[model samples]
Target: MTAAAVACTGLAYAFGDTRAVDGLDLTVAEGEVFGLLGPNGAGKTTAIRCITTLLPVPSGMVAVFGQDAAGDRMAVRRLLGYVPQQLSADQNLTGRENVALFARVFDVPRRERAERVAQALGAVDLTDAADRLAGTYSGGMVRRLELAQALVSAPRLLILDEPTIGLDPIARTSVWEHITAVREATGMTVLVTTHYMDEADQYCDRVALMHRGRIRALGTPTELRKGLGTRRGAAPTDPLPSLEDVFRDVAGSGLDDSSGDFRDVRSTRRTAQRVG
Candidate 1:
């Protein structure tokens, strides 16, 4: 296996008295897709923030491409591309304009910025919309634009947080296909956090399932499926249960509710809040 592109050891975070990410240890191999699978408020975002230098890791270690996140944040940032959970680009700007902005932030050479912007938009199949205002794009198209902006820096490590959220089935599928194509073409290390079991099963080389601020399980989709004994009682005539079944079985039945609730489990000084 290739060396680790990103590594976190005993990483923890908090809000108020709650522990949002409790001693999380993770590793992502070079050029591989590593998926972080979890329900809402499972600290997936918190962990991503720490790794991407959005939040401080007060008591643990996070490294990107052998650069320490705590001590060498600028160096780490230079090697990473981030697609935040929330929309990040200006609504008034054109798709190409957004890419250009990111290219500049990432310090792509002035002479090459235009070419880089074009390449990024092309990768996400947004070349046709490059000159169009971003506010005119659909949710999926906006997502593609966000992805293009992230890639404009040509980062080696790409971090996507709930990338396909709120997208329709067709749009989600298209986004996943584009993600797969991008990874295959660039050999970039990808770390994605998603609530979708199918996405984790289909696209992730390895997955870590998190629950209530801790990692509950880690394995490839097939390995995890087999480990759950889903195939044990299946006959030649019987079809296997989906990965969602394994996820529910291993991660617990508590996640089965559709309450649409959000939890604030951080241990920071801020008061905890919830959304529904």
Candidate 2:
């Protein structure tokens, strides 16, 4: 059988005295769009950082396509493409130049580099804006450019963190459309974290709601909503709970304390303002 695209067992991490992640276990199947949903301070980013080998796995195991993340960092990195919540595109770089940079960083052969860069740009429908400086692009276009950067590597597993934090509805829709189209074409597995319940409900094949460094609920959008309704003894004729309702059920109204620290808030707001 083909190995799972991503697997984590007994995963744990912390900052100083704070526990960011606690004995986590998760597995994502190949070619599915998986969402890691959580409010701030839920440890979603920390978990993704560990899986992408950006942070040392202080404890537990993380694997990508069956390879151990701790023991084989380079091998794992080769299989993954990541877009952090923070903006990664350089405002000074032309869209084409930005993509080319990633192609080189991912070590695409010199002979194939130009073509790969072009393809990645085209994939996000940025071909016309390819030569324009990224600073001039609109918020949506900038996000798409970042997606192109991640795709230049041709990774099997794509990880995105809060990909559309600060955008108009139209721009948000455009980003998800491109992501869905790319995934359909390449069969790449996508793992994303987002506070946007609507995005998760519409785009993710399955979602895991996390709180306090642990998974509180996991299932398809339909399943989770229906399950919540059932558990609460809602009448069969009652309206089903929305994903947001489920999120609130898990995280509660008391998010300020559990939400990530000041740095996280600052970074997220900065990204939003820039992208907005």
* TM-score top scorer: 2
Q: Give me the runs in candidate 1 sitting further than 4 Å from their true place.
A: 230-238, 253-276
Q: Please, what is the whole-model Cα lDDT of each candidate in the order they appear?
A: 0.82, 0.93
Best by lDDT: 2
**What local lDDT does model 1 show for residue 228?**
65
Tell me the deviation in Å of residue 127 in model 1: 1.4
RMSD of 1: 4.9
lDDT of 2 at 85: 86
lDDT, candidate 2, 1-276, per-residue tens = 999999999899988778889998999999999999988898999999999999999899999999999999999999989999899999999999999999888888999999989999989999999999999999999999999999998999999999999999999999999999999999999999988899999999999998888898999999999999999999999999999999999888636563466787789999999999
What clash count goes with each model?
Answer: 8, 1
Model 2, runs deviating above 4 Å: 254-259
Per-residue C-alpha lDDT of model 1 across residues 120-153, encoded as one tens digit per residue? 9999999998999988888888888888999989
lDDT comparing candidate 1 with the true structure: 0.82
Report the Cα lDDT for residue 169, model 1.
80
